[model samples]
Structures are given as C-alpha cells and as structure tokens.
Target: MDSNKRRHVGHRRDNTVLPLAAGVAVVAASCLTLFVKALLKRNSKPTQKQGKGREGGSAPKSPGAGAYVRGMREREYVRLIPDVEMLSLQSLLRRIQKARGWQFRDDAARDQAWARVLATAQSAAGGAWPLDFTPNDVTPEQLQALCDAVEAEFLGGLLAEQVRRAGRPRIRVVLGVDPRDPYSWLSGLHEDNTIFVNSNRWREEVSQDNPLVFEGALCRSKLEALAHTLGHELTHAVVLNFFPAMDASSPAYTPDDKHGPVFMWLNRRLFGHVGHASKRLFNT
Candidate 1:
C-alpha cells in the first residue's frame, strides 16, 4: 500500500484520551489476569464426565452414533475460555471503534459493527476471501507446518508483488514457539521478521472440524487460528517494511495507529476479522 492509503487524516488534540484505547487497555489487563487462570485450568486433569454439552447437560443421543460422538468431541474443544471469549469480543469492538470511530452504548446500538468489519475485509479481498486463502485443519504438531504453509502461500502470491514494488528482496519470516506468555498466543517483531506462536495457553485438545466462535466471528479451528495469527503478524511486517511512515516504534503512535488501515484491511481479508485469536479453551 502507498502512503496515501496508509496515512490517516485529522489529528487528535494533544493529551486527549481515547475511550476505545482505554477500553482495550482494560480488556488487555483483564485478559492477562484471566489468561493465567485459563492456563492452569487447561493443564489440570479433566474428570470422566467432562464430555457434557455447553450447558453441562448430557451429550445428545443420535442414530448416527459415530457422528454424535464426533460432534460431542468438537463441541468439547472448539471454544475459548469464557473470560478469553469475552475479552476477545471487547478487543474486536475496540478495533472496530478505532477503525471507524464508532461508539456503542449497548449491543442494540452496535448492530452494524460486525457488518462493517466484514465489509472492510471483503473490500480488501476484492469482494470475497482471497483465492489463495485456504485455511486447513491443524493438529498440535502441525502448527509450525501450518505457519510455513500460510507464509509460502501468501508470499508466493499477491503479497510478493507488494515486496517487489517496494524494491525489497525476497521476504522470509522466522517462526518461534512462545511457551512463557500466558496472555498472547502470538506476537511479532517487525525489525527481525520473527513471529512467535504460543500453544501452552491453549487447550490440551483441539477439534479439526469445528470452529471457535468469538463474538459473531469464526476462527474455523486451531489451524485457522494459527493461520490467521501468521497473517496478522505478517501484516505487521508488510506495513512496517513497506510503509515506514506508519512504523509503531515512534513514540507519537497510538495503540490504534500500530495496526493502521492497511493492517486492518489485510488481516480482515485473511481472517474475516480485524483482530486475531490469542487463546483457546476446552469445553468443560
């Protein structure tokens, strides 16, 4: 993207506080505290009766016993911790508010929030998900491979043109595992082009066919979550590399400014949301 497309017009008055940013900060802090507890809960052994439904009722019986069993298992694994899900919704709202300068007093007033997000994502992808954007199912051992696949697929396609247009050499990003951070599932360093993904904070088991829903958005699965994460970090790399003027290192940049319009647009296309999933929960 060019400077005109990436740059934001109008400025905030000096020392003015943004409520959306404050909201995000509050949610981030809460997520940090709850994330630790979530990790502990994930690591603890589960009881035999843990396979119940979302409301703690018995699993539904069906004529197709195999399908019923699979559905139960998927339901068991395809969720984030409750607090994490709530925080993710808050984070998504903050991002929407930041991007559109929208304010919502209640859920009724925010009816168009997700529609706006999807519109932007679709617009970014020329009215649909990118042709090369194929998110696959993932197992615990396949996270790194999934990352590699996303990087290869994206860079091998339109993203490569952006790099070439900037007169940059071929781009390669390093992927690392972060087991220590309980709050963030993924983070990146644009300077070194390194992306770190965390698994310790996720549930012990993941479902291949089920999607984790946050707010009204879908992660598709653990594979899709990690893929979207790579897309998110890679957006940072692309923005920081090609659009130096939008670099987050500057002291003057706001939290929203760090993930600028291009970042939002690209990620929205990649993941169908302007935000990333940072944790997972097992249905308990």
Candidate 2:
C-alpha cells in the first residue's frame, strides 16, 4: 500500500495530549496490576462450575453467531497486548481522582474492581500479544503489519459478529509526523482504516534514552503506548464504519452523541471492557 494514502500525518501542537500516549500510562498501571492478581486467581484451581464453560477449550459463543453469513473466511483471531508504558503506583493513585467515569467508582469495593478485571483478562487470553518493536522507528513493513494486527485483534472480531456485512469492513493503518501538534495520532475514516501517528515524536521517543538504571523499562513503555494507540484508533474506525449514520454530516454535525451507550458496548465487545473498560477510565 502507498504510504501517504495508507497513513495520515498528524499536525503538531505545542501542548495538547493525545489519548494514545496519555491514556495508556494510566491504563497499563491500573489494569496490569489487577491483571497479575487475576493470573494468580486463575492459577488457583478451577471449580466444576467454572470448568463447565471450558469443557472443550472451545471458542467463546459469538454474539453475532446466528446472523453472520460467510464473506471473508479469515477467522484467525489474533489478540494483541499493546506495549503501553507503565505509570508509578503513586501516579496511578493520583490519577484515580480524575477517573470520574470508571466502571466502578472510587467508593466501590476493591473486590468488585478485581472481578471485572479478571473477566477482562480471561477474555483476552485467546487473543494474541502484540509484536515488540524498537523505540526508535518502524519500517514500512512493520507499520503495515501493525495495522493488520490491529484489525485482527479489535476490528476483525467485531466484524465477525455482524449479520449482514459485505466483503468485510475494509481498514488499513499507516504513519505520519506533523510538527507543532501535541497529539500523538489521528484516524482517517472517510476513506479507509488509516491511522496517522506523529513520526517526529515517534522518532524522538525511539532515540530517547533513560538513565542506566532504567534502560529497557522505558523502551517497553514506548511499545505499550504504541500498541494502545493501535487498539484505540482501530476501535474508532470500526465504530465509524459500522454506524456512519451516527456521524453528523450535516451543518449541525458537531452536535451528536456517538460516544453513548452503544459505543461503550462496542468497546466491551471488542476489547472486553464493558461499561467503562479502559485502563484510563477518564482523561485527567
């Protein structure tokens, strides 16, 4: 695919924070902490009731089971765990106040939070983990593969559940660098599934190095952030594709509620986070 049409170039801003970069910091800290505990919980022997569902190691029941007809027979589900960076425990706690829309509120019990998190981990197990990349730069082939993985992990699964779909929800992703825009990335949906990430910033992160004490740790964080970006913009693209009617093309197009209950449900279905399933429940 041609690089320009496949990806977008994000305009640079002096101080605006992009969701892919800022949001993952909060998400990886909170959710991944809970995920470790979940792994332990999963390890502790399974009971008869829990084992019933996994009696045959079968694929989970499809939400769109009966309605979906054959179009593209690519049923290989590839789950990706984006290489989002980790935030300090203290940082996560501090950001908790800003998480106004969390699935469970601050006053809610910790066990409740744990339960929801465990469910997410279980759902993600069948999915594939994301490919690790150097912090410095991504080759054209790598960029294309990243886009394909995003489709398989997030968009493809949702597409499979649809009843009346044409050939398939066409999508692709590419990269771009725009100086002056603080945003890390943007999704172009009018034509195809293309994600334009800030190349300048991406390169900066790649060339950036921390102290000797914290070498690879920071690199891992950069990868996490990128993966989160893929998961995110791909989700947005799928929603836009599935319900273009929800988009406002009129003069008053700005006045619409695309991020309502339906959008949340879509996230839950695709990323396995129902209600408000993101690591960063809200933007601070």
Candidate 3:
C-alpha cells in the first residue's frame, strides 16, 4: 500500500511539472519579447505617442470609423452579429510580421502609428487623405462589418445598389502575408467574389516610406486606408450600368481600367474619393 502511494505521488508530480514548465516558457517568451521591443524603440527614431483606445463596434451611431464608414443612412444601423475570432489569427499575423519585420508597439501611440502606416501610404497617393487613424487590431469580422457598413452607407445611393442587394456575387477581404510577391495591395478572386489584401506588403511599403503625417493619428489613418481599399474593391465587385461591356475587339480593357478616368469620375460622384487607384488618378 505504501509503495503504491509513493508511485501515485511521483506520477502526480510528473503531471504538475509539465504545466509548470509550460507556464515558465510562456513567461520567458513574453519577457524576451518585451526586452526586444524596448531595445528597438530605444534605437528607432523619436516618434510621438498616441494613447487613445478604439471606439465601439461598427455602428453608424459610433464615432468616425476613420471617416471610412460615414454618410447618413435613412435609419440607424446596428450590427446584430458580434465579431467572430479568426482561425489562428495570431499565428498568421506572427508569421507575416516576422517575415516582413513588421514591428508592433504596446505604446498606444506607437501601435497607432504603425497601424496607420498603410493609411499614410494610401493618402500619399492623395485623395484628400483625411486625418484619421485606423488601428492594426482589425479582426476579420470587423473588416466584414466595415464592408457591410460601406455597402449600406456609401454605395446605397449609387447604381451599385442593385448588385449590393443581390449579394450573390459576394466580396471578401482577407489578410495574407507574402514576402516573395509584390501583388500586395489588393488582389481579386473574381470567380468567387473575393479580395486578398497583403498585410506584409502594406507593412513593407509604409514602414519604408514612413509617410506618417501626424503624431497621434494612427487609427484615423488606418481606417482611411481600409476605407479607400474597400471602396476600390467595391467598385470591382459591382458593375455600374454605365460600365462599358467587354467585347471581342474594342481594345482589351486592362485591369488598370478600374482606376482609369471613367471610374474616377464615377468614384468622385459616388463616395467622394478616387482613392489610390492609380498614379494618374492621384491628384485628379
């Protein structure tokens, strides 16, 4: 009986050690991460801090979604469904950021700045680049929410309303990190109505260019970037009645047509900005 008790205690100790060891590993990892972060900050340029927290869900009543989700709807808009957690989102972000050297900051200001890098880049391309900071913590669900809000609020009055209502040809935005390719801004899977936005490329472009306009304007800029991208994609998703139909020999319409003159004219009339569709459309 005494021998049996001794063996059981040893087994219990063995089980306890695994959790304890795992806990220790997590703590050590966190400490190391913090240390590295501090070292980087110390060596980096002197940047201002932004301590503001993100506001409520994607509600029209909620304040500026970095001016991305704006324009008065006939009635109040509410999101009935709560955001859902992405599948292994952390692991995915980690891999993308790791490969691209995308640095993150706990300092609200710094994180906000980092997040807005994409917005600044989009703005530098010029479309009244509004001063708004969009956060980096956008979940897949929130992204969808923003899209839905944009569709409802901005595109509702446009000719695209019919396409928006049918909803069969859906549009999707996903976060992908590919270091080897520069097709990072936005790629469309038209067959299935999907758009892939490369997070890695965005980070690389913004970080390298560093078009950060203001000290505390991270979230605003981030949302502006997303809003512009959403608008660009929405244009692709829906065909305006005015859109010239593709034909056998009328001069092959290149993918660049989406950001071409006609599209920009319609874009300005509809949602206010032509976005960074192309260099030619930048100032116009």
Q: Largest TM-score belongs to which candidate? A: 3
TM-score of 1: 0.37
lDDT of model 2 at position 151: 45
* Per-residue lDDT over 1-284 for candidate 3, one digit per residue giving the tens place of the 0 to 100 score: 89999999999999999999999999999999999999998868543342211121232222222222222221211221112211122233344234333233224433443344334433423232333422254456655555655554444433234445655555666666433343534433243455666654344222213442221122133454455566556655544322224211111112244443223323433344423343211110
Q: Rate the local accuracy (lDDT) of all candidates.
A: 0.43, 0.38, 0.41
Best-performing candidate as measured by lDDT:
1
Ranking by TM-score: 3, 1, 2
Task: Give one digit per residue, the lDDT tens place, for model 2 in 102-204.
Answer: 3222324323332333233223341222333443445555555555544443443443333136455455545565343434332223334445665544442
Candidate 3 weakest ten by summed lDDT: 78-87
Clashes of each: 0, 18, 11
Rank candidates, lDDT, best first. 1, 3, 2
In model 3, state the lDDT of residue 134.
29
Instruction: Give the least accurate 10-residue stretch of model 2, judged by summed lDDT.
Output: 77-86
Judged by lDDT against the true structure, how good is candidate 1? Answer: 0.43
